[model samples]
Structure formats: C-alpha cells, structure tokens
Target: MMAADETSARLTAVLDKVRALGPTLRERALEAERAGRHSDETIADIDATGAFEIGSPAEFGGYEFSVRQQLDVVTEVAKWDGSCGWTVWAGASTNWIPAGSGARVVEEVYKPEWVGPRVAGSSHFPASRGRAKRVEGGWQLSGGPWTFGSDALWAPFTNLGCIADDGEGPYLVGAQVPLGELRFLDDWHVAGMRATGSVSCKLAADELFVPDHRCVDFRDITGGNLDNGLKGSLWQAPSLGWSFSLMAGMSIGIAQGALERFLERSAGRPIRGTTYKNQLEAPLTHLMLAEFHSKVQSATLMTRANAEETDRLGVLAAAGTPADPDYMQRFSARVLVETAYAAKWCAEAVELLQRNSGSTAIMDFEPIQRAWRDARVVTLHGALNLEALSENYGRLMAGVQPHNFAGITTLDRFAPTAPNKAV
Candidate 1:
C-alpha cells in the first residue's frame, strides 16, 4: 500500500470527478428509478471516475480512504441523486468483505478490474437453515432466497451473511459466494431509493464450494481491526465503524438536496390566501426554513465530527501506535449513536421540506418528494435504526450486555455488525 496521504488524495480526486458528473447523473436519475436499476450509461460514467471502488484498500487499485472521505464523497454524489449515491455505497461497501478476507482475496476479486460483490450485512444464516455442510477443503453452501440484497445485479459475487456452528457454539461469519451460483429474484419495486435495485437473492440445493479463506469471522474483524499484514494505513478501523459515517453522509445530503429544492420553489412563491406576498416574506416561512437549516446543519456537524474521531483512531491502529482501548470501545458506540442522530435529523428536515413544498411537491416529478422518500428509506437501514442503537449505547454505558456482542447470532435481534469486544 502506498502512503496514506497519496491514496487519500487519489480518492479525493475521484470524488471530485464524480461531483463534476452531477449533471449526467441527475439526468439519469428518473430513468434509473423507473427501471429499478442504474442506467448502463450512469454505471459507465461512475466506473470511469473510479467512484465504484473508492472503498478499496491500498493493496488493490483502491484508495482505502478514511471514514470522513467515504462519507463526504457519498454525500456529495447524493446531493444530486440518491440512486447513484446508493450504487456508489453498495460497490464501495462490498470491499469490506474482501478487506476482512485478506490481501490476496481482494486481489482475486478486483484483479483485472474493479468488478466486485454485493454484500448483505444481515441475512438468514446458512447454518440455521441447515444449508452449510462441512466439506473437504471448506464448507458447501446452499440456501433459499434472502431479501434486501442491495446492489447485487451489477456485481459478480455475493457476500452472504451466515452463522457457523463450531459445535461448541455458533459463530457469526460471512461467506463470499460466487454470483453464478446464486439466483437473483427480480422484485425490487419500492417507493424510495428505487434506484438501488435491492431485490431478493436465492440459492437452491445447488451446493457451491467455498474455501476457508473466503470466510470472515465477525469477531476477528470487529472494531475495524482488519489484519491485512501490512504497515500501511488501510482498512484498519474497528469493524464497520466507517460504514455509519458513510450512511450519515447519504442521510445529510438527501436532506440538503430537499432543502435546496424547497428554497428554489419558495423564492417568490406565496402561501394560499395569506396576506403575505411570498413564503420568503412570511414569519412562519422564516421559522420553517430556520428549523430545517438548524436540523440539517447540526446533523452534518455531528456526523463529520464522528468521522474525524474515526480517522484518528484508525490512523493510530494502522501505525501500531498505542491507542486508549477504553476510548476505542466508547468511540464506536458513540459513532453509532451519532449516526442515528444524523439520520433522524435528516429525515425530520426532509419531511418538513416536503410538507412546505405545497401542491407542486405532489407532482411525482418534484425532486423534493423523492428526496423525502429516499431519506426515510435509507434511515431504515438496520445499522441506522435510531431507537435500537440508542438503547444499545445506553446498555453499553451501564456495563451490561450491549446486544450483538458475539456469542451467538441470536444474541442480538438487530445488530448488523458483530461487536468489537464481547460484553
């Protein structure tokens, strides 16, 4: 891996490139939304800019940029279009699977180019369904359909979330299965973020061989502590910590876009039957706009602050510097909590923006309406479930079992990533 600064600069360059393509991406948004798949032209444009592999580590032609970078880039793209932003997130996030697998594994997946997998963090465990069986070199996997396989269609592989029964107890693990071995069910019709093309994926009794190296033991990679066998600063945050930051970026960007549309529409627009000439001149309008601005600004600040802390801790871990272990534990918990807050404020802001948008927002073609829907849908991601993460953080503070702390898949009803440490 090259020096961290060089890689981060390259990642930033690509993000800037993506931002420059906003007009093209914006033009393709409705088409992608209607098709429930990103347009080939949009995909090609994203590919040309290196946005798809932004999450890749230094080992494989990737930047492995910090949490703040990831979130910033995703948010920048989402500011113009949500579907494209989501596709970027899905492609970049899939690298997490290979990052945990190891360097060689990542090389194989993106060797010639950056075609990669569509990973689902949550799924019906293979062992739970009796579909994973011990084989000579490794385990053979077969399973029924699983829903919410986001960004699977364009990818050639699938990261199947599973629980491996080690006889003593079941361990949370992830299996990288070939896409050729899995069947994709075309059923992604939805109201918002329709461009994600998140549909159900199915695998029949056709068992596929998966080598031991392709499996990621969640406990081993928790707190973003990926053992890449290198001194370079890449892919080494407590497990999945960066993901929340990226989600926060998307949440905030969507709300900001909605606000922009609101402002544009309200410039000289008037309220019905009111003595006030324009919404901009009315006291209630001033209050509403101020409320939206405050909520979104606060969300952006908090999420970015979390990103900075994440970067500090990640850099320390990568350099083999001694970091305060207590801080790391509490940091991850707080990042999740902050991430949920960001999502909450984004949703609230969007809802208000849409409400004040008047009858025009109901025109189906209005950007604010779609932004409202997109914000709501993205916040529903298991990782961003506000109430659940808040409670988990509280439990962690009380020195109690903070749910999903590993032990069994059944331990936490809603944890998307395995805990960095056992409770």
Candidate 2:
C-alpha cells in the first residue's frame, strides 16, 4: 500500500486535472444536452483526466482510489456539469464488476493499453432486460435492447444484465460483452439527464455467445465476492455501496453548481415587481439561499460519512475480518437510505433555487434550468427514489420484513430473523 501522504498527493493531482476542465464542462453542458450525448471533444477531455480509473484495479493500471477519494472526484466533476459527472460515475463504478469475475475475464477486459473507460453498464430496471440460457462454455444471450445503457457508446465493453433460468427458477445474471456485438438506439428522450445517452441497446443477432468466464451471478457482484486476486481496500467494498455512494456526489455537484450559477446570474437583477433593485439585497433572498445551502451541506456530510464507513469495512474485509451479517445488512441499508436522502435534499435545493430565479430562468439556454431538470431526474431514478427507500429504512428500523431482495433492503445471509415479531 502507498503511504498516506502519497495517496493524498496523488488524489490532489487527479483532482487538479479534473478541476481544470470545469470551464470546458460548463461550456459544453447545453451542447451535450442538445446533442443527446457528449461531444467527442468533451468525452476525450474527461477521459484524459484519469478520473474514470478511480474504481478500477490498480494491478490493471487503474488508480483504484479509496471510496472517499473517488467520491471527491465525482462531486467535483458534477459541480461543473451533471452529465459529465454522471458519465464518470457510470464508467468508474462499473469498472469494479470485472474484478469479481476473476482473473481470466479481468485480463481480457482491463487491457493496459485501453485509452478510456473499460466498461459501461445496463440499468437494473427489469422491463428492458434481456434473457440468457446456459450453454456449453457460455450462455446464449438474447431478447435485449437493454434500456439505460449509460456511457456504452464510448466504452469498449458493456456489462449487460439478463434473466437466466437455473432449473428451479429465474435469476439475474450479468454478462460482459464487447461493444461491437451490440446495437445502440437513439431513444433517450426525457425531461432530465438528457445528455447521459442512457439509451436502449440490443444484440447484433438473436443470440450472442458470452463466455462463461465473462458472466457472473448478480448476487456475487453486490456482495463483493467476485475476486480477481487484487489486494486493495476498494476491491473489498460492496459494489452497490461504492456505486450509490459515488452517485450521491453527482447530486452534491449539481446542487452546488446550481447555487453558484444562481448567485452569478442574480447579482444585479431586480425582483421584477418588488422594490429591491437587486435580488441579493432582499432579506427573502438571503433566507432562501441559506436554506438550500444548509440542505446541500447536510447532504454532503451524509454522503462523506457513508463513504468513510464503506472504506473502513473494506479495510476490515481485506484483513480477513469481514463485517458480521447483521452489521453488513445495516451498513447496506444505511448506504441505500442515505443515498436516497441525499438525492432528495439536493433535488429540493435545486428546485427551490430554480423557483426563485423567476421567469427568465426557464429559457432553453439557462444552465440553472438545466441543473434543475437534471437534479429532478436523479431523484426520479427507480433505485434512488426517496419514498421507496424511506419506506424500506423505516421497515428495517421498525424490525419489519424488507419488501425487496437482500443487498437492496438487506443482505441475504443477514436478513433479520423473526421479521414479523416487531409489527
């Protein structure tokens, strides 16, 4: 392991590279949204920052930075542009998946000479998922046009999910397939996050062969059990924990960026029908800004705390002292609930600022409006919805059974016994 001081220095250097792109990311925010994807120039600019390597294995030439450091980088990128930050989240978070598939698959996926991100991934939404059947040496994958294939266009490979039957019943499996074997659709139209290019995709044929080594049980990925023989704290962390934790940073960045732009645009502007010549001079404006500022700060604190705990658990796991089942369930629950809350708070903050920005703020060219839309979309994500997550957390706190699967509401082995004893 590197010394603490060296790690900090390396993190700072990576941050500096991404920080310098803030202006460029902000400048292109509108263009990317209009194009329904990032421009080639913008994509190359971000790739050059080395930010996407934060979650990859260091053995494969990736930085594999700690959870906290990775969150910091994502938050900073988001402060410039939501789409750019989101793209980083997709690329960086999925890089860890190949690690769990073991060495043979990892070797093929994480080539040292790869110039940009190594992978993109499909969303967990079941409606757009595909199907697979176990076959000799691999699975025959079919029935896709997987929706929400984020960052797939530029990635070398995409880890796609499919429903597979193992005799008794059906289960989800993830297969890492080369980008060339799939087709992307231009169907990402939406009210927010329009530039993420999270479009639908399908196999080039009715059946594409995915070698068994490249496919893994979805459970192992979330449990942090897919080992590629790396000895880093990051590889030991739960995949969902790292993914949602870093995603919370995007919410923070978008909220922070919206506030910055609001202040800049409101400087000398009047409250049209009010007596104040400048909105900043109004007491109401002061109160509104303070409220959102508090929300953003609170959300950031929650996100950072969860990230630290994730790293601590990873360290323990690496040392052969994995967290107890009950504790692991609680940790997983906290990460999920906290992530949802952060999304809620950040989205609310942006919405409040957008509302107070007056009529002109709704113009197509206004970045604050874009931030507002993007923030809303983040909250609306199925996995990150505040109401659904809050209900699950409340159930856990009340000792009621969770309504969803383990790793989402609780870890499988650690699910509380006597769930109905509380109610």
Candidate 3:
C-alpha cells in the first residue's frame, strides 16, 4: 500500500512539473492549432511525464492512483492548455478498462517504451467499421475510419470496436491492433483543438493477427467481471476521495488562467470617458469576477464530491463486496454528466471574462484567447455531451434499461457496422 505522504508527494511533483511546462505547452498548442499539427517535442513532453501511466496497473510501473487523482492531473493540465490536457487526460482515461483484452493490449503497447500509451477513441461507433473474425491463434481484423484517435502519432497501438455476427446475437468486441499496420487519413480539420491530431484512420490487414489473450469480449467489461481489493478502500472514503475530481480541476485551471490574464490586462486600463481610473473599478468587472469565482468554486466542490463517491465504490469493489451494478452505473452516469456541466460552467466563466476583456482577448497570440477557444472546443467532445449523458443518468435513476453499459453510446453505435466496410 502506498503511504499518504507518498501519494501526496507524487501528485504534488506531477502538478509542479505540469505547471512548470505550462507556458511552453500552451505556446506549442497555439502553434499546432495555427499550423494544423503538433510538434514532435510537444508529443515527447506528454510521453515523458508518464501522465499516461496514471491508469496502468502498478505492476506495470504505473502509479495506479485512484480515478480522482487522475482527473485532477488532467484538469490541472487543461488549465495550462486545453488541447494538451485533453490529449493527456483522454489517453489516461482509456486505461480505465477492466483487466482483459483492453488492458492487455494497452499493456503490450506500453511494455516497450514505458513513455505512456497513446490513445484516440470516439464514442461514435457507427461512423466506422472495424471487425475481428475468430481465427486460429488470433483474430483477423479489418475496418476503416475511426475518429478522435489523439496520441496516435506516437502510440504504437490502437483500439477499434467491432461486432461479430454470432449465430445467437450480434456480439460487440474491441480489437487492439499494432499501430504499424494501420493507415491514417488526413481529415481532422477544425477551428479549435487542431493540435489533438484527430483524424480518420483505417485498419486493414489480410487477417491482422490479434492473439487470443489480447482480445477481450466487450461483454466481460460491461458484465463487471473485474474484481480487485486495493482499489476499494482508497476510493471509498469521502475525505480521501476526489481522485477523479481532477477533471473539474482542469476546467478551474483554465478559468483561473483566463482570469489572471483578464486581471492583468484590465487593471489600470481606462475605458474612454469613464470616471473610473481603470476597468478594475468598473461595477460590471467586479460582478464578473465574483460570478467567475463562485462558479469555479461550486464546480470544484461538485467535482470533489463525485470523486469521493467514485473512490468509495472502488474500495467496495476491491473488498470483494462490489456495489450493486445498477447503483454503480447510476453513480458513474451522474459523475460523468456533472463533470461535463462543470466544464461548461468553466467555459462560461472564460467567455464572460473574454467578453469584458475588450479586443485584447481576441489577439491570436494571446493565451487568454487561446484558452477560450480551447475550452469551447473541448466542451464539445462526445464524452462531455451533456444532454445525452444526463438522460442516461435519468434512466439509471428511474430503473430504466441503459442504452449502453459503458456510459457512453458513441462506441456502441458502431457495433452493427463492425463486420463490413468502415462507416
């Protein structure tokens, strides 16, 4: 078991490192967005932090910290720069899969470099077709076009969901394939988050081999077959909870960064014909700051509470006394929705500050402008799609069958098209 001091020290060290690199990373993100691609150095820094290692098992040299800590790291990084935080956090979150094909495949990817794994996934399953047919030694996979495969540039492995036409029913599967065998399409052109390097990719092999061990039936993960002991206690207690709570931290961090810039720019800057010496004394400015602070604090608390609950459940699950699957599902749904809502709130704060910051906020080279755009873009990620997630949570609360067990339908929608051509 890791001592309290050990965990605290580790978290602090990572946060410090992230903060130290924030300015450089922020600049790189802006450049990538403008240039339509990320630099190799930016990718290397992400790998070096071992931020991707947060989700792997300790046996594999990962910190294997609770979900809350992972969230915190992501949130904090996002504050410095949204795209980097998004890439890093998303990469780490992919490690949350149960120990089976998903975990094994990821482990295989990380085994060689230990520099963190690369991840690019989209919940929009219907948009692509990739499939694995049962075969000798390994399964054969073929498909084309998956979206949001961030971190694909350096990642040696990638995962795609497929469906098998089992005589009984359509069975869903997630296939892990070596990055070397896949083809990337240049399609990720957008106004924001261009640095994520998200593009369409095709995986075609005359029978790409996926060893049996690396193949995991999606049913197993959704069925809740994973059972571990240590995770429960660490995640259960409220005081010790808030590990996954870091996601909100990222939003807060972004808001904080913007707020700082606004303050610096607005202070002593007079509006024409105004009696006030500077914008700082403006009544509207005071109200904006107050609202921003209040919203940030509220979001932080909600994030903390959800993180605590997630931890508590982990402890229970680890103790061999897993919580009711339905309850767990509900909890997860709520947290996911709330986190997105918090992000929205944070984004609003940024917008407010930007609106009041005058023309300075729109300067392409200004970090405040970049932060605003990045937060706005990231809020649109399918994972953060608030309405769908809220409805999912409502179903759980009302004892209605969930649309998808994984809490995100983006992946499940692709099941039907997995066998034939890529969608």
TM-scores, each model vs. reference: 0.88, 0.94, 0.85
Cα lDDT tens digits for candidate 2, 1-423: 567887788889889999899988898888889899988788788878888777777777777789999999999999888988889988887766777767877888776566556778784444436888899998999987788888888888888888888898877777888989989898999998888888888899889999888888776765556567788888887666787888899999999999999999899889977898899899999999999989999999999998888888888888888776556666777788889889888999999899999999999788899899888888887677667677766776876645655222334535554433311
Judge candidate 3 at residue 79 and give its lDDT. Answer: 72
In model 2, how large is the Cα lDDT of residue 206?
Answer: 87
lDDT of 2 at 368: 91
Which structure among the candidates has the greatest lDDT? 2
* Ten-residue region with minimum lDDT total, candidate 2: 414-423
How many residue pairs collide in each prediction?
A: 6, 2, 26
Off by over 4 Å in 1: 1-12, 115-130, 223-231, 322-325, 404-423
Predicted structure with the largest TM-score when compared to the true one: 2
In Å, residue 46's CA in model 2 sits off its true spot by 0.4
lDDT of 3 by residue, 112-156 (tens): 654445544432253346666888887776665666677665566
- What is the Cα-based TM-score of model 3? 0.85
After TM-score superposition, the amount by which residue 357's alpha carbon in candidate 3 deviates from its true location, in angstroms, is 1.3
Which 10-residue window in model 3 sums to the lowest lDDT? 414-423
lDDT of each: 0.70, 0.81, 0.65
